[model samples]
Target: MNRPIAVVTGASAGIGEATARALAAEGFHVVLGARRLDLLKGIAAEVDGTAIELDVTSASSVAAFLDAVPKAKVLVNNAGGARGMASVADADEDHWRWMWETNVLGTLRLTKGLLPKLIDSGDGHVVTVTSIAAFEAYDNGSGYTSAKHAQSALHRTLRGELLGQPVRVTEVLPGMVETDFSVNRFDGDTTRAAAVYQGVVPLTADDVADVIAFAVTRPSHVNLDRIELKPRAQASASRVHRG
Candidate 1:
């Protein structure tokens, strides 16, 4: 009577936290990973899931996280964020480095680490949470955009590479959801963060989690390669309609 294991990174808050709850409701024994151990533990307690401290940007941390996961049926690569919005001409290397490491390399490490376990389960699924920036470029967003593009490419490539295998790879491209993303990008500027969602309603973390839950619940023969979701006010990364 054991439930399938689903490991969700960044499960401390936002989409990751919501997804963990959603999956748990669907009867999966969730393993929540994030650097925020206090938040992670609290959420895990509520969801009846395991809380493991994980810093996706660190190789040793990823290795240790993987050690805790003896087996997994699903892995959600959701631990990533933007650092800043400096223009290309004034781009901060530090910002770019963090973006690349977290979004691009982070996905690679987690997916590669769990692929064996996923495949062994006979119905493995890899869900990567990339941004709308993955397919569109916007001004002052080169670092975030580039990292998402690379992350998307990595996830998409697996669809073809693991075609004959039991593993399924799905890339989720989300436009805008109200979360700590903007606040973090602007260095704790809550004013700026609130402005991003003002005048126009944005998607909620639960909205995206609903999609992830749906994707994984589908039949084994049905593979959802890519899922792009956005609020009605958003048309693209740089195009959002405001009242």
Candidate 2:
């Protein structure tokens, strides 16, 4: 029997990297993808997986990545993040566009590109890492929230379209995960990024990765439609107990 292959995008760090590691530990041949080839290589080495440079926002990049690994038992759509945290009125259109292109369309491209291979895997899973913003809106969260909402919609529609198929679609929504998500959102502003998780116990990359691994590792007869993971200090998108 051959080990299954798992492809994880946005895998340079955080959730994507951790998922690759977890799946590899579970006997899967993991392939890590990200724009940061250097970072991906380090994580890939740690997990004993292959590293491929991938930019989900570009069709060509996605194609290249898919061509390298034409088949996969699992596709973890995790290549995305927020650009900035600003109110709706003062929102930067560029930030909004980046959010949409990276979060929504990025996930869309990979899911569509890999659907056939996933179906052919016999027991396949498409797991998306959305955010708590998908469930609720918050002040200064318009840009990220909009993109996440679209992503949430995409998953729901994919599920409907793929019903009765061999592939399982699962959306994992995480609340306040402490990772490069905030740093990238703040554009390398370590001070600001540090504040987001200060005085609070937010979810970690491993936490989300563990949940995703559990979902995909379940029996073929089981399919986890949607799951939300949050820390006790976080009740909602904006209600973070920073104490």
Candidate 3:
């Protein structure tokens, strides 16, 4: 039998990179997509997978990536991040717009573009990496949280709409994973980023990757609809132990 294929977005780093590696280890031919071609190439080389230049915010780039990949049995929609930390009143309109573009619109566009292929696979799985912010909001989290909420809603709708179809939709909501997410959101403010998870045992990218792999590897009859993985120190979005 031919090996199953998994396509991972944001494959250049963090959970996306780790998930791609995990899927490959689980005997899936992985297709990595990200804007950083050099990083994507390196990751693909390490995982023995294919790499495609993808900027999720760009429809043409996303279309090109999907066109380049062979039929995929699994799709990891993990290309998203917050842009800045500013209260809604003070938030820059551009930053808010960018967040919506990348976090909400991008996910929808890519998922729609690949829906046909996934449905035709007969045993397809979609694992969307959402965040606790989807359920709980925080100060300066207006734009980011709203986008996540939209993404989660999309997953739920897909699950309900695909009922009886072989396609499985799972949403993974993780809290405080140790990654460049905070740093990037803060525009490389290492101090602020470090403070976000201070004294807290944050989730690792591999932890989320493990869950993603498990979700996709389950037998066709088993569909894990929703998973919430939080660090022990993180009881909720607003409550984090910094001691």
Candidate 4:
């Protein structure tokens, strides 16, 4: 029998990368997808997996990646990030569009494109990484929060749609993860990014990755629908224990 295959998007860094590693260690043949070919190559070498260039915003790119991995049993939709810290009143329309393009449309396109492949696998599973912002909006979360809401909605709908099928859909909503997410979102403002988790134990990429691994590694009969994880210091999306 062929080994189970897993496809992970945004596998170049953070939770995505960590999840890929964990899955690979668990003996799944992982396919790493991301725009950074170099980073993907490095990860693939380390994990003994295949690497595919994937730009989630581009339909052609998404299609190409899916075509390349036609027998994926597990799909991890993890390519997304916030653009700016702007309130709804003054938020840039372009930023909102970009966020939606990546967080919503990207996920939809990839999931839809790979649905047939997943269904064919007989034991397929989808694990999407959402955020606490999906449920609780913050002050400057106009664009990102809205996009995450859409992502979570997709996961929920997929769970319902695949209820009768053998496929399983899981959504993971994590809070205040200590990753390069904030740094990239803030355009490399390291100080600001560090301040976001100052004096508080934040969730690590491995933490979320472990949850994702657990979700996918369940028995064929068990389907984990939604998982919400937060740092002890984080009470909600708006409230975090700071120094």
Candidate 5:
């Protein structure tokens, strides 16, 4: 079957993995990319898609991943994470660097590398999974919020840059998702990660994936510019109703 190709970054787990599954179910030949070849291979096998080892933070890896993609009708920039939550006064430079590299440059590298193919496909879609932090700022979360803001800017700018082109740009901003995101942010502190979602229900990876699948499946002319989804218990980045 000559299915349209949909490339998903950070496909080893969480949102990336779920998006890969959702896109595959949508009949797109999903190309899963991540540092975990083991997990990527398994997910790809299950989805009947291609698995490519990718570290979006590395330009060479992005180049190689893009080259492996014969054609790209959709690109899902989901390979990003946050690090230590430190106040501005005590900000850890290393954490900040990692955040900038993975969340900002990572998205840039992948999106820029596959842009032409997306345009050439004649009906392309770029779905960037940013965060509610993209617009809202919270204490001790400067590292992540700033990076997301920049990523969101890059994705949003494409709207005008690709005007009159066949490509569509959509940004998915999710709030308080219960994933390894917190665990990684806390440096593998699973207990801390568990506490993040202890008070209220958080959005699942599949929920975000479902939204992405719907956005890309829309008619070619209908462009869903930006979508912000969160659980009912969440009102904003800092205003979650925890009981």
Candidate 6:
């Protein structure tokens, strides 16, 4: 209760869930946010954190969530996910729009809402969970890659804009992370999701969470701009050493 606050979006699953648990262990009074209040409550209870029903796409929801938490030193933007695997020519525009709204605007909403609290702490940190898709363009990954790329730009621009402020921005880009991400991306096709990681040792939510925690826990004088991580089975967005 005495430690500074750290808020995490999409805290019900995957990297967000892991980040909440890991941040709690790092002495932060973690606040869990997501549309699924039930799931958030479970993780919040386990980590001794606060849970709120936060739909980042809604301005009112984000405002309400922030108004409840007055003090935040860290904010982890992890609310977005990939939607489909169709190439550009066959891609669905709806999916593309959804990705952009969630990944770009959602993060923007929370960051803008919580900036005051974070700055007040005098050691604010914003860690965005982007992906290798942010940097690499692959066939069938155009929409996702576009969204992530925009998200990456947001992180970079924030870093520049907040240079004189107390906040530091960091982007955690992971490759081939084995999470519900694949399943969700494939629209609940469990078999297809399983196949993505079948023959390769992909990174886990815990692994990325570990990196996130490390970046924010550094000496107050040091700011880690970004951290790019991947499993040994992956080389790039298109290169995977599948055995």
* Ranked candidates (lDDT, high to low): 1, 5, 6, 4, 3, 2
* Model 6 misplaced regions, further than 4 Å: none
Error of 5 at 45 (Å): 0.4
* Pairs that collide, model 2: none
CA lDDT, candidate 6, residue 123: 93
Q: lDDT per residue, candidate 3, 129-229, as tens digits?
A: 99998888888889899989998998889998999888999999999999999999999999999998889889999999999999988889999999999
Assess every candidate by TM-score. 0.99, 0.97, 0.98, 0.98, 0.98, 0.98
Q: What is the lDDT for 10 in model 6? A: 91
Show pairs that collide, candidate 5. Answer: none
Best by lDDT: 1
Off by over 4 Å in 5: none
Alpha-carbon lDDT, every model: 0.95, 0.90, 0.91, 0.91, 0.94, 0.92
Per-candidate RMSD vs. true structure? 0.7, 1.1, 1.0, 1.0, 0.7, 0.8
On residues 1-243, what C-alpha lDDT tens digit does candidate 6 reach at each position? Answer: 688899999999999999999999999989999999999999999988899999988889998998899899999999999899898889899999899989999999999888989999999999999998888999888999999999999889998899899898899999998889989999999999999898899999999999999999998778898799999878898888878
**lDDT tens digits by residue: candidate 1, 87-206:** 999999999999999999999999999999999999999999998999999999999999999999999989889989999888889999998989999999999999999898999999
Return the lDDT, model 3, position 18: 97
User: What's the CA error at residue 158 for candidate 1, in Å?
Assistant: 0.4
Q: Please report how far candidate 6 places residue 186 from its true position, in Å.
A: 1.0
The TM-score of candidate 6 is 0.98
Candidate 5 RMSD to the correct structure: 0.7
